[model samples]
Target: MQALEKRLKREVLQNGKVEILASSSWCVPVQSIDVTYQPVKRLKMDLLMKMTLLTFQQAEIANADELSELLLVEELFIQDLLRNLTGTGLIEKGEMYYHLTSKGMMQLENGIYEEEQEQETQQLLYSACHEVFLPVDIDQMDEYDELPDLFRYASEEPDGSLTFVEEELIEVLQNSREPEEEGEEQTVITEILSKETQQINDIPCLEFILYDRDKDLLFARVWNTLLSQWDDKLEKQLVEKEVVKWREYYLKA
Candidate 1:
């Protein structure tokens, strides 16, 4: 908790816009689930989009009325498509014509059109150790520190306790996400089957009452000791889990 206090004073107090009112400690269990899902990938553009862009490239410069006749699509629909294209800055609309912008030409050069397709939507345990709760995703950090046992997954029934082989289950998510392909939409996970328990670790936290004098607002934020950072998502999760109460509950103090 020393780390939490030092960080809060150093990072928060220096800002004149905010001040720390009070703080309290609490323990929360965070679960790590090895989510396995089928990765369905596709480009952001669909067939019509590809056709529209190609039409622009072929015709070089054409008005919506001309494009509609050339593509054999309705003029109104073509107008909508052209409007979308211009809105995204891929194409520019001239006094009376629409043409592919340099950005649109680059998309064709990058093989984006070739990959156009459809996609659908898709969708840890806690252990208490030391005074600090370590996260199962500790592997994400560069420094392992000195605690070798922190990484080891406990065997079933270790020391006759409740078998700490990544104990318990909870609904939580960690990014462990894929690299974003700039401007390209990727496949979404429809559902999550299950996650293998890597290890059980506790998430120790300090809830700090923050006052934004500028806004005249008091809010609650949880400082994650394990991650050594203020995790807004985890703070919201804790509030949802009732680990932290509403601001009114804290202001009474």
Candidate 2:
């Protein structure tokens, strides 16, 4: 039993990098280093960047103030980190929000520099999405218990209406669609939703509900319907101009 105890103590000392184990009669040195340390600023920056990237992975846009609150850091510190990250092309500032650029996404998926485990990443994704995308008054819904916070691109209007981006894209698509017969009108949301289900290229479609303080609207589209059509040029244009207008209406003063 004494031998077993001694072996366990040695294992703990080696694994923990502990320097000393004191006995009643003497102090025995276990390892050369007594402590491990990292610069406080560096540690803070590393954590900030990781959390920012994870947040961006879930939300289309994030701002420094929001990030600071989420990371429990000073707003000024987060702003500096964001500026530096933007310069490196890991983050892109869109109007009043910051988005994770393609480069940042690549680095995250490839496990560059600082990478979290798969399960950890998934947990972060779920939490971030819920934080940013779920309706603020979801608990008030009659079927709130049955609702799951699924991933989707949406923005909350100043009037409290949740607008699905894909629904806007669908409206655009519907307007541009040419009638199959002469003088025929384009398909409308009512016609689309009245059907049992809708599909594009054989892929199943999903319905999105835009909930407001007073009303709820239903929209239908397949996953990636809008994303697939958005090219780099269009994305850039939206980020530079249209997204600003969106922010103006969606974000409160």
Candidate 3:
């Protein structure tokens, strides 16, 4: 990864933008590029996985909707993540709810979750690289002056077209929008917020995009969105799951 980063920095010096074509196995043919990899924020997969485990620990029986709200991630993402966890025997799904498996509990307790998470991270990275041009925009930096991370996940439409949505990128664009003439700014904001939601298999998702203004580079991180729009019943369910404990705890306050 460090080698790739160095190569990308060199390429950025000569080109305003560079395109990355990753093989299905997530391998980038270095000979095909003036650079091998572009700079990006490190993936947060570990944090996300740990958070998911913690959520299950907190709520004994929870669905993707509940987990989405708890994690502030898109429902579709939660569902996909759950599926991956299930494959590792870290989680199990029955009907529409999910529970941590005994193996999962043991891994968390023994700090083995980190190792498992690393393996999963590698898989996700390879998946994101397959046959996609991950474009990184080189003219803008996120609010933190940091480049956004990249991941591979997309929703397929009925017509067979792929859609990628990035809530974080959208949020960054919205927050960083320059103030315009009164009504003009409002219009821009509205347009930004009105970005159509994308989904896969009817599951909500977003595409990832990374930008590095310092290097004048941009790339698409195509991934599922972390914005789940669940119904009120789901929220109520989460409340009920911990309402008694919440009440008892807050009552003293």
Model 1: per-residue lDDT, tens digit, 131-163? 222343545433323222221222233321332
User: Per-candidate TM vs. native?
Assistant: 0.36, 0.26, 0.27
RMSD values, in order shown: 15.6, 33.7, 28.6
Better of 2 and 3 by lDDT: 3
**Candidate 2 lDDT over residue span 28-130, tens digit each:** 1111111111111111234557777888777655577777777788999988877777766787877766778787887666544331211200000001212
Q: What's the C-alpha lDDT at position 194 in model 3?
A: 29
lDDT of 3 at 59: 76
* Model 2 accuracy (lDDT, Cα): 0.37
Candidate 3, residues 206-248, lDDT tens digits: the string is 2212244566333333222121221232224334454465445
Q: What TM value does model 3 have?
A: 0.27
Q: Lowest lDDT 10-mer window, candidate 3? A: 118-127
Clash pairs detected, candidate 1: 31-124, 31-125, 32-124, 33-124, 34-195, 122-189, 122-190, 123-189, 123-190, 127-201
Candidate 1 least-lDDT 10 residues: 165-174
Which candidate number has the best TM-score? 1
Q: CA lDDT of each candidate?
A: 0.55, 0.37, 0.41
